[model samples]
Target: MRSQFLIGSRAPSIEMLTWICGKPVFALQRGTIYIVALFSTICPHCPKTIADLGQLHEKYGDTGVVAFGVAAMERAATADEAGARVDTWLNKELPNPTISIAFEHTGEMNKLWWVASGSYGVPTIFIVDRDNSIAYIGYPDTEDPALLERVLTKVMDGSWDNSAEAKKAHEKWLQGALVRRANVALSIKDFKTALSTIEELNEAIPDNPQFREAHIKVLLEMMHDFEAGWIVLAGLARDAIEKNDGDWLLAAMQQLFGSPYDYSCLPSAERFSMGKVLSERILTLCPQQDGISRAISYGAVARYFYESGEINRAVDSIEHALELVEGESLPDGEKQNYLAPLVQALAEYKGSEIPREFAEDPQNRS
Candidate 1:
């Protein structure tokens, strides 16, 4: 569904049965510009978005711009469960509470706002003007923070919805929302719906790598059309190499090596051959100093080597990946997440059991 509340449309009422730190909040105070951030506590990116909102609130609170967070209820089984999760996240991850936090218990809030607006993911921000009209609905984080700040300023000044830039931003957001909806369809295994949605997106925005990636994923993994999928993958690889686009090359590698797709169904030799080519291209385009991308590329190449019975080459590749991880600066948890898997793979390659110290609890990582 496309968003019902467009740039000039009236925002849905904020009145809902919301729990704030285990207490009920009946309504948002009227007569102020409100930035309602719809997010999920479990989303890896939500914390940073929430922090950004908090900063926005701090900067504009006195100017009558209020930022509030509403955690979605999709993940939790009950209202109480959802409230508890929000409370924990607020306390641990976002302690200052610069912005009011609310836990959406019933799905009503989402149906009224998120679904009505065609937003399918967390961290979507909706701006409510002084008159309670919707001024903006899009991502909180942009490549240009100053541009977002200027938009927010205009939002508070009652000029954003009428601006040409607002129209452009809304159009861009709608396009992204369509892509997100297609991804949702793919996640639910509605391959036909996803296929059609992606095709529509591709036609609308021709040669978009994002749409192409989704199309290839559906073809190869869901439809089991290896012939068609390989053609797209090979073309993408060649295009990425020719353009020297490390990001697209990495995406191509993931299509072949990433989880959820059972590549064992394909001919091992051909799969390995494709993987080797993609990996070499990725390494050539993406330097070793690029850290995470390089590490991931190495891991993909290592997996290809291991499956091809080149045990020593696999060990070498994984070792180099692990060495890069060790030298890089990453959070302890994130470092553990990458290191544990690589170490486990190394142990398996060497015909030894995974060391207890290197084994990670899957439940703890996310």
Candidate 2:
């Protein structure tokens, strides 16, 4: 896919309904470098990204650099809801937000900049040089903090546009853009297009497990091609075992037993066999003392046993998972996040009501 905006092109104008923080920002100032950050309140990583931009602004603002944050209403259902979400995030989550924040009600800002730059996700950064030319457009967190400092210094010095690092960054941005397009296709049920995009990504970055995972999902969940999916999954499972990657094994197990895919379509015998092998491998690789990992692994095993008509073993597995969580050292809120699901699962296994303390709705938690 071709990028919509290129380095050295004129930067897009900043347009929004109202400024949520600081003075109103109508456009880029003349003869000043600007760092424009695009984000959403719901994005898990936006807080850190915004915080980093704050630091960048603190260091460069006095030196003719300005920072602006545009928060898009990506997941909000209505304009009012969007405003409220942004308010909560600013007031509660980030009381002393260091950068200027703007709210986009109609997504005009996103279209003018994010779409124009082929950016498909939040926490994207765009740098506009003193001449109002786009100097950099990519994820801000892609580079190490030290490297990013050097790159920003170059941008301020008017030498980054033609730098070798800039060219490499652009190529990496293209790859990420391709992955984003593939995900969009998947979301819209365009299986053929998604598969083709993923295939191209696999060829471009064969070592990326993300593409492999996407390929498997498209095959198994979207296309319902169990034969092909199983082959790919078996290979991934083998690789995970060889690399001692418990995370990949757990992800595979979730794909086998979780939602958005009808695993019931696969033969029970084969499904159970795959589950047993994956669960065993995950358990072996994950140490018993690693409560979080052990909890998740045992949960997967419980799901497998529960589906295989082993009620007693299913309960036993879930109980083990809960026990591990009890010994975990996570903060109370975080521990509850983990315990809530296990408690809900245990209640389901025992055919009892979900306890009040653990009954916090998943949708409400976030």
Candidate 3:
């Protein structure tokens, strides 16, 4: 049997000491549906997930859904150290069910539930049924209220079916809103608004996965104040990482590459490090994936290397992608749209080796 680590597996119980409301909450029972968000106090996405969980807690507390946060402590001080971190942050945010801060049971819980042990990134969400069965598994965007609600509704309803018409409607609503809002924001050149809408869409529907890619595409095509927007995008990408959300992270990578802003212009090496991390994850997650997604990711890799001034790497990524893509056969502009960058990047690095039309000529400068 495939490992029952996903939905429908009996959840492993956690009996540990935690503090909530200035009182010790000991041996607290996991609710009918237990949301064990595997995260670390320092994980960039953890704080935002916690904050959103707080909001969800308020909305669903009476619905037999319990949101428990589990952070892996890798330091010497351990649980005490991690708990203090949670406490400091929790105090600043709205109060929700006791955020169970633990240090000791990290490995044990992972082994029991069959989750990959250690490396608890932020924004990881797990909604287990009251029967202690893992109902819904995947890193959800806690920031987006709609996405969070949709995920919780499925868990509370005791049905793990993500194919329900309701879920489709919810997704449609989110995507339509994001794409439409982005277009409107683009027309007006309100980059901040465009970025804000995209950010909200990402947070609301991190799992929709493609939504972030679309967001990045539009942002790159329209937005000008990329510096501030890029910072927000970084945090949002970090949030997707803790959730172990491969698709959203991939989308984030594509966006950075499509971005008009130059990563080399930034003084810090942080952007490059993040780009590398995201690229590795994408390769690990998406193998042989096709269509616009493959094109977008490839274009992104090319742009990432190009922005970092790795001209050779950029050229190679684009060239390989061109080989993979049957662009001449594609009728829609979408395929060609993504290929343009790679062609230009290749021209920049390899010069006349690329075709005349595809090469970076006077008109190719954007």
Against the true structure, whose TM-score is highest?
Answer: 2
| Model 2 C-alpha lDDT per residue in residues 1-366, reported as the tens digit of each score | 534355668887675556878766788877988888888877888888888888988998899988878886554567777777788988866788898988887878778888767787788888888888888787756657666667779988877878899877866876777778887887898999888888777766666666788888889877989888877766776666566677677766776775476666666676677777877787787675377878888887777777777878878988998888989888887888888888888888888999988798654775
lDDT of 3 by residue, 1-366 (tens): 212234455655565434334222244355655566766555676666766676776677787756666654433356666566666655655354344444433455544432431112345566666666655555554355476567668667755455574355445444554556667777887777776777777676666656565555554445534565456567656865666565667667755555555545443467678787887776665565765556556666777787778878877777777776654467545455556666776776665465665555434444
> Top model by lDDT, which number?
2
Candidate 2 Cα errors over 4 Å, as ranges: 1-117, 120-175, 207-210, 351-353, 356-360
Tens-digit lDDT string for candidate 1 (1-366): 333345557777667656584233355456888888888877888888878888898899889878878886545677778778788887888887667788677788888888878876778888878777777888755577666678888977767777898877876776776677787887798888887777777666555676678878888878988777777767766666566666776766667666466676656666567777777776675574478767877887777678778899989989999998999899888888888888988998998989887777644755
lDDT of model 3 at position 148: 57
Candidate rank order under lDDT = 2, 1, 3
CA lDDT of every candidate: 0.75, 0.78, 0.59
TM-score computed on alpha carbons, candidate 2: 0.55
Candidates, ranked, TM-score: 2, 1, 3
Clashes of each: 1, 0, 5
Cα error, candidate 1, residue 311 (Å):
2.4
Model 2: lDDT of residue 258: 56
